[model samples]
Target: MKKHNWSIVLLFLLFVSLSISCKKKQPVDADPPEGTESNLVSAEVTGSYNSNQLRLLALAAEYDAAVPFIKYDVSFIKINYKTTYKGNEIVASGMLVVPKNMPTAPSMISAQHGTTFLAAAAPSNVPQFAAFTGYELLSSAGFITAIPDFIGYGASKNVIHPYYDEYHSAIAVRDMLTAVTAYLKKEKTAFTERLFMIGYSEGGYVTIAAQKTIETSPIPGLSLKAVAAGAGGYDVTSIVSAIIDNGTYSDPAYVAFILNSYNITYGWNRPLTDFFREPYAGRIPVLLDGTNHASAISDQLIADPTALLNPVFYANMQNSNGELALKAAFATNSLLDFVPATATRLYHGTADETVFFQNSQLTFDKYKASGASKLELVPVPGGTHESTVLPMMLNALPWFQSLDK
Candidate 1:
């Protein structure tokens, strides 16, 4: 079920002379019994990293080579826990990497993952998936790193992923945190109550969503200290407009994915032929079947969004006058209305064609205008979505680290 490749950072960075390698070792994880509060279903070892390996990962993510480094050997333990999704309680799993030994009380980090289509590559299933890299890196730094599989992945593979549905996304992470705490207690692992949230792309959206949920309805035990969101489609409406106005987008399949998701989740019941053109109309149902790898569809589709969509549908997608159903549904997840009080940094590449850099700029402006005191947008000049990955992560790790100091 291995899917995401967070290690893409290395490959991306290496394009400009990045060269590094390392090894690591650790004891296999001990099995734990199913417990309460979001029960800990299992904790199995995935991989280990020596100090050098940890340092390599840090460097690959563009972490400052000058920052004093620590060598806390790290290992991945996939934890399956109980969480609610779309109102039904279900078992979900995620990656939890920890140092072989603990200090007094280490900080906690919720490393929300970016978009992933394949179930196997989820944090809980495979240790080497690149998405686990950040978790491992943080764990080596003495942070209890948690990465939820979200829905439609990990233990809940059969469940439909809510995509940008912020409500369900927030609940899933919250429940996962509850499960992590319960498991840590059962293991007698020492960790602080301080929590940080960070992620990229879809993960970024989930991070913001969770921050909003915590602020709007503060959780008693979990306190959020800081947040970092990178290249997420925060302004949902603006994203739609970008697709329509540009006549093309970096990923046309996303349009189909979103349209189909809204139809199924909201019961719009809009048939494929109503929106898509030709064989694509017939092919989209299976392409978006949730069973295919995300790229399986995107790779097959052309970047020209207009080519994939029917004329009427494309025209309607241009603005609010048409397709009221989707507009309203996307509105529910838009971050424009939510003003995060926590020290939050929004990072986006000025050259990002996929998610659009303007998303962050608009969010920062609205937050400031709406009276949010602790919000800032960090722009990575000339960085594309992929190129910005390491920089965004590097920015977040230190910002979170600074909070404790």
Candidate 2:
């Protein structure tokens, strides 16, 4: 078995994490209609930035001039919105970045962030840093951007993050967009009603999930224009099998996260010891408690799946009929079946190890075979999971700008 490089995985999480709603007011005199109530719970202005100030911030963040320069001053607002979780309604939080003084009605983007365990790294919590790297900077480029905290953090922090769960992930993005649309309309922020999606890694999975939901179900007042997803684990079963079969994976933290998330999200209620080895299993709950960073968690885990996971559980996961519930969950959550109708581009680093480039390739091939003419696959030469992000952004931003009309 190849000894994986832990440092790169650590750096990937650190670098990506480092990088990467309101309610309407009720009338005093008369109550609003029952179904007419806004999805938006509340919005609070966090900060405002002028174009020049945003330009300097982008430069400091190392974004090249090839990317769109700051074109409009922007306001950052933290918003809470009503979104569903496992058939129950709950309030979730996100960051809404609205551009000021645009020449025309600006388009909107649901910018999803890569995976992060730390709550502080959630977009609404770290608005300024997110502004430049996550979604805020794009707002400065004149698009209204909404970055949802994705259920495990922000207002829904107590809930288990349904990592890689299709329905939960899709609803988080969809409802946030719905809430944002209501908020923008309430505030009289002019937007073109053209919606775009962008994300990398886990965000990439989320972008695709949201795109599929919107394209298929058709959200009222939310029209998806285009999307760019990079290095996502869309083929969930294949990715998990590869990890188990390969014996060693560079990022054990990710493996733990998925297992734990699946266990909780699916109501499997399996003990961590059923999946992971003793000491690591004992430590998993503490490691994933929304305070530790991914790097910190990775530091404590072994890279070899055989060593990190229980021998029986690992062996069972390899068999088709074994671990039936978990297998069903993985199959259900995988994004392989959908053929996106909207213009879409799947981006992947050819050398990416964490989520594997093959995941995207397989997805692109499937979509193409299903007759998705507007789909394209973009390979970032020599880009690893961490390195692929900047290049992906550089290419995606321009492409999104071209289609922004």
lDDT score, candidate 2, position 266: 80
lDDT of 1 by residue, 1-405 (tens): 122355455634432231123222342233443543435566666565566655655555555441244458866677777777767778888888777776557888998887776556677754343344355566676788888888777788876577888887888788788778777776787778899988888889999988888888865467889998889899888887877788567677777777776676666677888888877888887776555666688877777877878889888877559988777888878988877899999989999988999888888899999988999899999989777877776677777878964
TM-score, every prediction: 0.85, 0.90
User: Distance from true position, residue 253, model 1, in Å?
Assistant: 2.3
Question: lDDT tens string, model 2, 1-405?
Answer: 111355335434443443342222332221223455677877777666677656555545555453465688887777888899888999999888889988888898899999888877778874323223445778877789999989888899989899998998999999888778777777667788788899989999999999888988887777788899998899999898988888578888999999999999888898899999989999999999988877799888998989999999988997776899899889999998898999998999899889898888899999999999999999988889987887777777788899877
Task: Itemize residue pairs with steric clashes in candidate 2.
Answer: 21-42, 21-79, 21-80, 22-42, 22-43, 23-40, 23-41, 23-42, 131-136, 131-137
Q: Which stretches in model 1 have alpha-carbon errors above 4 Å?
A: 1-36, 55-70, 128-133, 288-296
Q: Relative to the unseen true structure, what is the C-alpha lDDT of residue 315 in candidate 2, on a scale of 0 to 100?
A: 83
lDDT score, candidate 2, position 289: 91
